[model samples]
Target chain A: MKLQAAIDRVSLDRANEIAKGLDGIVDIIELGTSLVKDYGFETLKREFVGLNESTLLFDGKTIDEGEYEFEKGFEANADILTVMAGSSIDTLSKTYEVTEKLNKQMFIDLLEVEDDKIKQIANFKNAIYGLHHSKDNKNAFDAVSSVAAFHKQFPDISNIAVAGGIDVDQAKKLSEQGIANIVIVGGKISGADDPVAAAKQFMEVIK
Target chain B: MKLQAAIDRVSLDRANEIAKGLDGIVDIIELGTSLVKDYGFETLKREFVGLNESTLLFDGKTIDEGEYEFEKGFEANADILTVMAGSSIDTLSKTYEVTEKLNKQMFIDLLEVEDDKIKQIANFKNAIYGLHHSKDNKNAFDAVSSVAAFHKQFPDISNIAVAGGIDVDQAKKLSEQGIANIVIVGGKISGADDPVAAAKQFMEVIK
Candidate 1:
């Protein structure tokens, strides 16, 4: 399982510094929605000039105007962009097509989506289906159990990513479970005193 | 009924120019989600100057991290900010609390959400429940009928706003129906050859 470090709610300069520090150390560096909504994509595209080795993912959380958001996100040099699973099927299909045509990736954020909705959108072969827990929920996230249940429900969706307050131990267990392709650690890794050291710890455990 | 002129898919300068143009004419001026994502709330707070009249609505389309997004959005001088109804109940409640505490309005974008979900979230009595059609969904929207049906379904929820390809005739009908509190028009008003003239025409019709 690959480790994806999410950098969120920070200044662009700080985010760039973190990305450069974590370059090639983690599989992916996610510019979380807060960054995108706080600083804007144009800044990310123009000013955020690091990540020589790590892939950059912009969590646009696009719920509508999928084509425009995807195109803009790709133009911002995002290797992957996220669209909400709660978005209309038309929006999902449009974003998937845009991602495929651009040869980039799309991460479908499965936040607050019903099973029926997930089943309908599970056909995007190249897209990574993210099993996300709401940040405001204040609930415990059992990543391993959530992933197992999601796998059982949508066996065809091979590319799975799980997020929501994930820690190093949970990352290790997820790696052992051998189901999720990417284990997204946000505050646990990025919010630590030494993000690089924390990322390294997570990488070691997952490895 | 009120007219909300939405400025979207344009440069920040253009958005400002349009917002300036539509000020005082329309009941509300929406800096659409594209602007919030493209330029950001910080930029909007700093650069988007000159809205001397008309309520400013930032279409944040906030799905999660509700309190943070809402606080930032309101601090950016937005009189109103939007949250996705499809968001977890926890997120919705948190955002509602933030809005209530801050004395700002929250517009719940009911895009692509099932009626059951609507029924659950309808109790946010102060929120303006928006019946929105996804721009990506290539489907026709009957504003008058949709508002009528939604009113019938959620009669207790007084505030209603409708969007998606609304025209002057439909605006007139919605005003006549006396259901929706706001009639949100996008390209029809903002994308017109003469935006002020177009807005005036709609205002005349609704009156």
Candidate 2:
């Protein structure tokens, strides 16, 4: 299992600083939707200039106009971009095609998506299916149980990822479960007083 | 009925110019999701300084973190902010509460949302329920038919808006049908060679 650290709701300078500090520490570094929506692609594209390692994922959460958003996201130098599973299959297909064409990656954010919807959209084999919990919802998400249930439901979905308030212990549990390809940790890792140390802890546990 | 001209997938300077051009011509000027994602809220907040007459609607498409996105969108000087109807009831409620508290407006974009979902989310009495067709989809969307069907299904939803490939004739028909509170037209006006003339024609027909 790989550990993905998400950086969110912070200034660009702060985000860049954190990204640089966490470079090569985590498998993937996510630029959260807040940063993208707060700073725009132009600023982010320019700010996130060089990184020798760690794939950059821009949590675009594109719900519509998939082609335009995905193209722009890739042009902004994101190695991976995300789209909502709630989007139409056409939108999903378009984003997936764009990602494939660019030889990049796409993460399908399965937040608020029903079973029927997920089944319909599960055909994107190469796409990483992210079982996400909404940030607005106050409900507690048992990451391990959720992943187990999702795996049972969609056994064909090979690349599985789980996100939303995941901590080091949950990461370790998920890693132990050996089902999820990637475990995404947001506030637990990025929001810590020492993000690098926190990332190292998560990395060690996941490994 | 009101006419909303959506500005999308363009540079900020061009968007501002178009917004300035279509200031009082259209009832509402929509800064589409592309703009919000491309230029972002901070740039838009600073750039979209003042409007002469038309209300500004930002397509924030708040799927999660409803409060944060809604508050940020409203603070960006938008008269109306959009939230996805596909979002959870909690998210919808949170955004609606913010809208109510601010005495502003919320437009719920119902794209790819099932009838059951619509039934669940239809209780936001003051919110403008937008019946939107995905641009990514190649399927045909008869705006008038869609509006009529939605009205028939959810008679309780008083404030309704319809979008997707709307033209002057279709706008006239929608105005004649007298169900939708607003008719959203995108490329027909903004993508036209003579945007002002096109907008005037739409306004005249709707009137």
Candidate 3:
């Protein structure tokens, strides 16, 4: 399994510093929705956010106006962009087509979506289906069991990612379970006192 | 009934110019989600986005991390901000509480959400439940009929708003319907040859 380090709820300069420090340490670096909404794509572009080794994913969480957001996100040099699975089918289809046409990547955030809805949107073969737990819900998320169930339910959809309060132990367990393609760790890595050391620890465990 | 002129898919300079021109012309001036994601809140703050008369609604479309987005949006001087009804009940609850505490307003965008979900989120009495049609769907929307049906279904929930390809005639009909508190017109008003004239026409008809 690959490791994705998500940096959120921080200043742009701090996020950039963290991203540089974690370059090549993690497979992907995610600039969460707070950064996008607080600072925006044009500013993100102006600030020079290219990584030397790892891919960059901007969590746009697009729900509508897919073409515009995807185009701007890609233009801003995002290797991967995210769209909400809860968006209309047309929106999802448009974003997926944009991602494919641009030869980039798209992550479908399956936060709060029912299985029936997932079944409808599961046909995007190249997209990564993300099993996300809401940040505000003070509930615990079992990454291993959720991945097991999701894989069993949607056997055809292969590229899977799981996030929400993920830690080193859960990352190790998910890696051992051999189901999820990517394990996304947010505050556990980005909020740590020493992000590089924390990322190394997660990388060691996942490997 | 109030008229909200939605400005979208335009440059920030053009948007600012249009907004300044439409200051007192419409009841609400919506800096659409495009503006928020394109230029960002920090840039908007630096530029100064206060209106002379109309309430400014930034379509932040807060899906998760509700409190943070709400706090930032309120600080950015938005008279009202939007949260998706498709969001988790927890997210909706947090955003609503923030809006109440700030004494601002929240508009719940009910795009692509089922009625069962609405039933769970409809208790925020102060929120304006907006019946929105997906822009990418290319489907015809009857704003008047949708409002009538929504009112009939969720009669206890007052303060309704409707948006989707609204024209001057439809605006007149919605005003006659007397169900929606706000009628949002996008390209019909902002994309017109003479936006102030278009806004005036809508205001006359709705009144």
Model 3: lDDT equals 0.94
Q: Which prediction has the highest lDDT against the true structure?
A: 3
Instruction: Estimate, for each residue in A104-207, the C-alpha lDDT of model 2 and write its tens digit.
Output: 99999999988999999888878999999898889999999999999999899989999978887888999999999999999887899999999999988885
> Of the candidates shown, which would achieve the greatest DockQ relative to the real structure?
3
The segments of candidate 1 whose C-alpha lies over 4 angstroms from its true place after superposition are none
For residues B65-84, write the lDDT of model 3, one tens digit per residue.
Answer: 99999999989999899999
All candidates: DockQ? 0.89, 0.85, 0.90
lDDT of 1 at A163: 98
Ordering by lDDT:
3, 1, 2
Q: After superposition, how far is residue B194 of candidate 1 from its true place, in Å?
A: 1.5
Instruction: Report RMSD for candidate 2.
Output: 1.0
Off by over 4 Å in 3: none
Residue range B1-207, candidate 1, lDDT tens digits:
899999999999888888888999999999999999999888889999757879999999999999999999999999999999999999999999999999999999999888898889989888999999989987788988988888888888899999989998999999888889899999998898889999999999885
The fnat scores of all predictions, in order, read: 0.84, 0.84, 0.86
Could you give the CAPRI-style class of model 2? high
- lDDT string for model 2 (B164-195, tens) is 99988899999999999899999998888878
Please give, for residues A68-133, the per-residue lDDT of candidate 1 as tens digits.
999999999999999999998899989999999999999999999889999999999999999998
Interface RMSDs of the predictions, in order, are: 0.6, 0.8, 0.6
